[model samples]
Target: MATPEKTGDVAVHDEIQPAPLTTTNTIPDEYRELDNGEITAEALGGMVDDLPKGYYRSMSFIGTMLALCLGQSSCYFGFVMPANVLTIINEDIGPNPNYVWIALIWNLTQAVAFVLVGRLSDLLGRRWFFVGGQSIGLLGSIIACTAHNVPVLIVGSAFIGIGAGVQLSFGMVVGELIPNKHRGFGISCIFVSALPLTVFGPVVIRSMILHMGAGWRWSYYFNVMLLTVVVALFYFCYHPPTYAMLHARRANHVSPWKMVDFVGVLLFTAGLLVLLLGISWGGSMYPWKSGMVIGFIVGGAAILILLVLWEIYGAGDYPLIPIHLFKNRQYMGTILTAAVGSMVYYSLLVLWPVQITMLYDTDSMAIGWKSCIVAGASLLGQGACGVLVRVLGKHKLQLMVSVSLLTAFTGAMAATTPETPGMAVAFIFLASTFLGYVENVALTIGPFCLDASDLGLALGLLGATRSTLATTAQAIFTTILSNKLVTNIPKYVVPAVLDAGLPQSSVTDLLTALAAGNMTGVPGITPGITAAATEGNKQAYSHSFQIVYLAAVAFGVCGVLAATNAPNSESKFTNVVQRKLHHTGFDNKTTKEAEA
Candidate 1:
């Protein structure tokens, strides 16, 4: 009654009238409906006030931001945890020649699963897949905690890898949902989470292994608890929009067959699997020149070629990666920067832990704490980069600077020797900070270069690139580390054993024993011989660090060059606008009219 009393001054005005005429030129019923479907002035005006503008207000906005943060942290944890536990596992299980396989399997499984599961997430609802992935990761930790042998541990690692692939899918989902203004900050948050986990994961695992009775198993169990808590939180709070819902609302169509790119998925999965298998077994399980290794490499190359062709030309309407995305120079440039950045970042991760343990002669716990410095610094660096992006309106320059810092850090680390002062640890920490800066910039810029419709597939390809680079880096760097160890250990340890007056048979056994880090075989040698061999082992490890550090510098230099070529801010903004217009079905005429 109160509202009815206020109904006044409401003018019902018909200012214009249209003359009615029947003609063949009249709009058809369907065309009239299509014209009506166009976004109206009222709709545009309404969105200006209601649409989310930044990270603080929207629930879905905040949920996605947190989801991406947690998701990235979980992925990095799985990737780096095994490397942290490598020495501890070797000590407990006795050094088997197959120890490298345990490390390789983690990277291999992630590379293989990323493409397959990412596409499935686009086909299914992202909310369930995201939650399910975390659940699967929890199961992996449970299996790892109960693993009794190397094979079981490898199986557990594969599950963790799959979970990582699923977690990565959230990058695409969140990128799709967040408003353009807040996206760079949200993506930077994800990378910020990664820096800590990368730097600290090893440190944490090492500390637990040294202190706890069953350190390695307990470390796995701890991850399970953490991931389980995150999963529960995600289930209760996160709600990603479904593909069906989005498509139905936006395109007014829902066809599963049209939505999926099944053949592309198969080819990509097969190609990645073959490539990873080749890298995993080429030198360790089978000779690099062996028929099995060569066959895998060749077959993987073939499938990759086929995949590119299908994505570019073979697929009529549905392609996993839209070929047109590559036409955008900014998009391709950002992706290139990301690929190189991932390679350097993960390679350093693979090498640094081994270097610390071998050089410092510390147990896992000490290494874990030492690693915290790098991870913590990286978080700070990422935060700084985000601030700079907002102030300067230039992200590519930050990427270039980060790459230069990483290169400098790597070169400084290469200069370290066994007799180097404790201050050298600062070099590693600084390198981690620069690496984090590079990561934040690349992650922020990559998705922004693409159209909204391409966000899911673009992120999937980004994950694929990161996984591929990580696997390649692990394979190449491990090969370098192993070769260096093999070459240096004999040169240093053998001469030291003979100089100490050990018998020929004893010297041979002692050298082999030292290479494996088992002092039991040195009992036959004199006490002088034992002391010499221990010093010799230290010298060999120092030499290996030099090799790893040099390789890191080279990788960093390449990353810098790639970053230098990255696209500028104006190009990225233009590309994003074009993509959004395309996805919203606003043709050039409509866009021009709206602006006018």
Candidate 2:
């Protein structure tokens, strides 16, 4: 082999090349020089030479698959655990007060941490932060497991949120290692693994809570064990990709200080934390018009403005978020669609179980099992879409179909009434399935638009967007439900009580008693008041569901519009040649010159 020559910032090989054995074997002339002074044939061959002779025997491949599986399992476990037991916790701890703030705080904290940690990991490597986050989460789990009060549980949940933020860094790391041809398959596989977890996690948690006389604390303990194992495995077996290794190999520059974006991070965190806290507490703890709420909103808005100004003007070329990425029409569309989809999906997850318990008078275990039907359907939908993408090669079409189905289901759900048939349960399952398809499609599509180097940031942004939207959606939906329930309960129940021949003065007492889940407070009421109150409770729940479903329908329609504008599957770029040609002005002449 002849000596490699430097051209501009790239190296070029001057020796003859060998025949390509696989598509990935084709090294573009730009990277061909980085082959360490070897001919193209030698360099390209060496890149993939580490593969095992047989697929099953490849320990590295197996490890990678397990890592992906664990990642999805952790995400599914984290999300479904809270939804399964939220109603029970509220009933036990809330004492008739709305616990919507709990949901909002969990989501908001996760979003804030995800963006801050993601950018930090991008600058500082993923190892220590990831390990430290898992440790903190473990401590939180211990606190929650041992907690006797709601305040302690909320603190524990905050730890879980921080851990989730740290775990998101793995998405980018996995993307970097997987081959382009297998990238979609790898992602799909990870997502598919979540199916079992989502379907069964709630069921198992609820069962444990009921059968063992355990509280929600046991669920936290289970998660602690699982996460501890995961942390240990990651610490011992995995090595995070370094900034120097990623950029230096490609002849790109790395500036540690610029990459950190400390000011941008601080401002972003402060803004998001304040905004989420305000949203969580407003209408639940403090009235929306209260001074505390106003202060949080105003403070958060100010911090957000500072973040935007710093990123746009003061950061120069090293802004934490490369705002230019948002200019891509497909990127913008996908992100918007993801936000709306998350809002609808997560709100339903939080509210549906409560509705089931209130309407059917079911126990937590039954509600948990019923919830599994939706997640099971989602798993099926995701799997079916993944196969369709592989065969029909129409990712966007699948996404559109999924969004349309979700919109229809949500719209139908909005029309539900006290007399709505039990068969309406199928709609929840269908909606979940469609939403799952939307999520899978968006996850696959977002990364295709960016270079491999930016995959981590892309995944982080996706998580952040989803978390933020979900937090706001939970708050809005909960407020609507609480207000409507508070108002409509009297209207429907008062009439029913009067018709049942109960004393008129007892109406207010009956409602207050029902809201507290106690029936002993009303005086001069007949035995029929219990039946009338049950009917009243049903009506109140139906009304809340009606409003929730309407909001979900609106969100689904927005998601559909966003998905319709997203790029088609054919626009995906994978090969080094395609990426280089797209970035630099690579034409046939440049290719021929490089060959010469």
Candidate 3:
């Protein structure tokens, strides 16, 4: 086996280095565990990339890959399934204005957990974390499926969000296990696993809502089952190599927990929570000008500032966020692009369904299939980009072209009208396709630039930054869209309905029914008045949605600038495996036992 050189207590590699040549004659015995679960680094064997090309074709490796893919699919479910069925859920559970929490809390928990989870997984092994995360998601599914109120549902969403956060951290695990050159393909495999669901998940959810009484809850039941299988798969299939440094630290009586930056964790978690809370509350639960909103925003900003200062000066050797990563142009550019791109996508993900429900069709099935086009298009884009990157290997150009095209397409969406629904669909599909390309570059590029030891921290920071920024952007977009709808409805719909011979006394009821997409019992309502009111409602939603798309276009311009800062690191791709899976008897081991 090739021996790894060490620096102090940690094993550090600044760049990808080819493993030393070894022959079967020089190979060591199969890794045997000590009674305490620790195995020496020498016994752990050589890098998997150094093995023969077809060495990874074994069933064990395939099972491991399947588990990773399934883990990613569960995260996708947590994000996509809930948002699509939220309105139906609210209808069954009463018209609670706070129903937005079902989505917000999911995002908020992830934004708060990414940094801590990433660093901890780096210190601790990843297997249990992956399994435990899915288990939590299963528990969350149970809770959400059984919820009778919005608050209960929000609590369930929070658990699922936390689980998704850890599942996202598995990106680091995927990077470490795959050869560096094949990272794009490896990462994309997990993403592509969600493609089937992205394309058809909405159809299934809508069908359930329409056909079965309380069938929306059945979606959560399916989630529970999927997560159960994911947890078991990860537990049985993922058997990662035991690192020597962990054993070294254990022998010296060092504690992994001691290395944690508790203060930084507190500051970051609290700050993100407060900031997102303030943003979510603004113009929804409270006015933007409310003292409560301003106070929370300002306080969160202050705490975050303190976190930066602490991470730089106060946290000793092991800061929660590695300070040096900020200096790498490629890493920073990737993070910025990913965050901004997600913000742009959020404009479509959150608002497009609302646009469909208000203007195009209220039938659950139609709304489901129609609103899912962008997601399906994005999946195709992601798959195409994955293959293209593997073949072409020019990420900078891909990012540049994708962001440029995405900007043009997103800006065009502002021209959507009730008469031009086809135009909106076309532009959004084009925008989403390019957005997927941008996402592909952002998700895979960071590993190329950073060292192997910092993989967990880097991936974690990327996920957290993207989640926080996107959540904040969603709030801003919703506020702008809501404010515009409030203004435009009164200006356009009120006049059109009144002119159609609708009585002034019944105007409020008529407007409410139009917004709700049900005109069952509005006084003085006639077919002519309904026709005029429908047209006006469509016009109001079109105008409001246009403003939201215009706002996303502004962010797209920023994404273009961020993409420029990214380097073309085609040379960094190589057949270097940072950490190889041991594939031994890890299924029965506890974390402390494994490290001992």
Q: Judged by lDDT against the true structure, how good is candidate 2?
A: 0.66
Residue 94, candidate 1: Cα error in Å is 8.4
Local distance difference test, each candidate: 0.64, 0.66, 0.76
Pairs of residues at least 3 apart in sequence or in different chains that clash in candidate 1: 203-368, 206-364, 206-365, 207-364, 207-365
lDDT of 1: 0.64
User: Which window of 10 residues has the lowest lDDT sum in candidate 2?
Assistant: 578-587
Q: Candidate 1's error at 488, in angstroms? A: 2.5
Cα TM-score per model: 0.80, 0.84, 0.88
What is the per-residue lDDT of model 1 for residues 1-596, given as tens digits with 9 covering 90 to 100?
Answer: 12221112222122211112122233322112122222222111111223223323444445545666776777655656666567558667756666766667777766666666655555454667768778888888788778777777777787887787777665565455443444556556666666756557766666566677877676677678768867876676665444443333223333556657888878887888887788767656777789998899899989989988998877756677667876877666666666766776677666665676677746646666765666676677777766665556667787777778877886787678767737557887787677767766666667666544445556777777777876676677777777888889988888887888877777667876765767665656777888888878878988887777788677677777777766555333221111111112222223234345
Worst 10 residues of 1 by lDDT: 574-583
lDDT of 2 at 456: 61
Considering TM-score, which of the candidate structures 2 and 3 is the better prediction for this target? 3
Candidate 2: TM-score?
A: 0.84
- Give per-candidate clash totals: 5, 0, 0
- Evaluated at residue 338, the lDDT of candidate 1 is 68
List residue ranges in candidate 1 displaced over 4 A: 1-49, 52-67, 76-79, 87-102, 116-125, 191-199, 210-214, 249-254, 421-423, 503-505, 570-596
Q: What is the C-alpha RMSD of each candidate to the true structure, in Å?
A: 10.0, 6.9, 6.3
Candidate with best TM-score: 3
